[model samples]
Target: MAERILIVDDAAFMRMMVKDILTKNGYEIAGEAENGQQAVDMYQEQKPDLVTLDITMPEKDGIQALKEIKGKDPEANIIMCSAMGQQAMVVDAIQAGAKDFIVKPFQADRVIEAIQKALS
Candidate 1:
């Protein structure tokens, strides 16, 4: 079965980009969220195999959402999404239990590689 993924991003365009990339690569989209708060809510409701989370968002950041999800499901597979020069946030995400991360303006191969590595 295709792995289910929850896509979380504040921007509609970003979400669409990710969804396009993921679906084309044979991954099922379990759900989508526009902010960190929504992300946490969707995490519990959908319980997708993996999550692609944006670092900066309204109502709560990715790191905070990641923590909340992890608190609920320690085995959750979360991949933080960041932009250039957000190394500090990325590190925080890693320390907070994210399985891996993807940078924005995403490359199809890099995103797939990260997801594969995380799943493996």
Candidate 2:
């Protein structure tokens, strides 16, 4: 079965971009969330194979969500997404147990590479 990925981003455009890339690459989309709270909630419900979590969002930020999710499922596969100059949060996310991270204005190859690396 194709790996199911939960995509979390505040921008609908960003979510759509990621969904396009993943679907084209043959991955399944388990769900999409626009905020950290929804990301956390959906994670519990979907139990997807992986997650692409955006760093900045309303309600809560990605690092917090990453920590929360990691607290619940240490083995959960999560990849952080961020725009440029959010290096500090990216570091925090990595420390919090995100499997990897992809920068915004995402390159399809890089996105696929990160997901593949995380899933592997």
Candidate 3:
């Protein structure tokens, strides 16, 4: 079966972009969340094989959600997504146990590469 991935991003367009890439690449999208809180909630419910979590969001940021999810599932495969120049936040995300990260204005190859690396 294709790996199931949960995509979390504040921007609908961002989520759509990721969804498009994943679907075309033969990955299954478990769900989509508009913010970190929803990401956490959906994560618990879906137990997807991987997650692409956006760093900046309303309700809860990706770092906070990443920590929470890691706390619950130490093995949760998570990849942080951030815009360019958010190096500090990305560092925090890596420290918090995110397997990898991808930058926005999504590059299909990089995004796929990160997800593949994390899942592997």
Candidate 3, residue 117: CA error in Å?
A: 0.5
Candidate lDDT scores, in order, read: 0.95, 0.97, 0.97
State every prediction's TM-score relative to the real structure: 0.98, 0.99, 0.99
Residue-wise C-alpha lDDT for candidate 3, range 33-93, written one tens digit per residue: 9999999999999999999999999999999999999999999999999999999999999
Residue 1 lDDT in model 2?
96
**Candidate 1 Cα misplacement greater than 4 A, ranges:** none
- After TM-score superposition, what is the CA distance of residue 4 in candidate 3 from its true location, in Å? 0.2
* Candidate 1 minimal-lDDT segment of 10 residues: 96-105
Q: Kindly report which residue pairs in candidate 1 clash with one another.
A: none
65 in model 2: Cα distance from truth in Å?
0.6
Q: After superposition, how far is residue 48 of candidate 1 from its true place, in Å?
A: 0.2
Tens-place lDDT per residue, model 1, 37-92, is: 99999989998999999999999999999999999999999999999999999999
Q: Is candidate 1 or candidate 3 better by lDDT?
A: 3
Weakest ten-residue segment in model 3 by summed lDDT: 111-120
- Native RMSD of candidate 3 (Å): 0.4
For residue 54, model 1's alpha carbon misses the true position, in angstroms, by: 0.3
